[model samples]
Target: MTDIPLSTWAAMAEIIGAGSIITGLLVVLFQIRQFRVQQRNAVAINLAQTFYSPDLAQALSLMQNVPDGISLAEIRARGPEYEQAAITVCTSFETMGLLVHEKIAPMGLVLDLAGGIVSTMSRKLARWQEDLREEQQQPSWGEWFEWLGDQARAIKHEQPPAHIRLDQGAGGS
Candidate 1:
């Protein structure tokens, strides 16, 4: 066989080097995507755990009886248990809000998981939350929770409910 020219060999070497670099970059990109998916999965699992916790379940059960637009004073008047229930619901949603804000959890996942509950609870607790901010002298109190509620409301308005979407044969709502 004839020997290859040095220039041709150099070109082939450059091509191989470039291919290797591209392959490395692709691997890195894939790894980054996988890491993000893993992170989201972890967040989802944590959220599910929180949702199923006894405290949250009890809080939700208690809050179901609370009327919309109930004031902080009204909650206090009911009993310590009512106040505790409100606090538990708020704190749980607050954590979820922070997670959504930080991109640790996707908004779509949150909306699908707890959109209606967030929307309803946010409305029910709006006055109480506002009063809490004033009483605590901290304007940022429950800010993320409010933000999350807003997101949930907006998505609720823009999209159909899961039952309707699912009936249409869509895999996800």
Candidate 2:
């Protein structure tokens, strides 16, 4: 076989090196995506455990006055033991738009679930409240109350009335 030219050998080496680097980068990206999915799952398990984890609730309660935005450091300050997990959970929650953060504190994190729930409930309650307002605007003694008499009868379905004694209260015919 003919000896390969030095330039050709060098070009082959470069191609091999570039291919390895690209392959390594793709592996790293895949690993990162897997890590994120695991982290999200962890957060979900932690959320479910919140019902039984008094510490979690206690820590979360500290966030009541956390203002419209906050940071991870603030969460860490609540309890040192859970700081790492808290930061991960908080960051995920923020990304999910479940919590809002005004300024990204160097270590800042804030849950925006309140914004979501409030907005949703506000719209729903507004409709209910509007119905209430419309009802109030009607003249007093609306037809709707006519159902009250039937409701009272249902409540008294069994036997004689408790308040009124038939033998004593009613005059014999």
Top of the candidates by lDDT: 1
lDDT of 1 by residue, 1-173 (tens): 55998899899999999999999999999999999899889988888788788998898898988999899999999999999999988889999999999988999998888999999898899999999899999999888888999899998999899999788876554
lDDT of 2 by residue, 1-173 (tens): 56999899999999999999999999999999999777656654553453455653553444333443333344346566444433332333333332112222111111211223222222222332334337567432212221222222343444344345466555554
TM-score, cand. 2 vs. native: 0.34
Alpha carbon lDDT of each predicted model: 0.90, 0.41
Off by over 4 Å in 1: 170-173
Give the backbone clash total of model 1. 0
Model 1 TM-score, all chains together: 0.90
Query: Worst lDDT window (10 residues) for model 2?
Result: 104-113
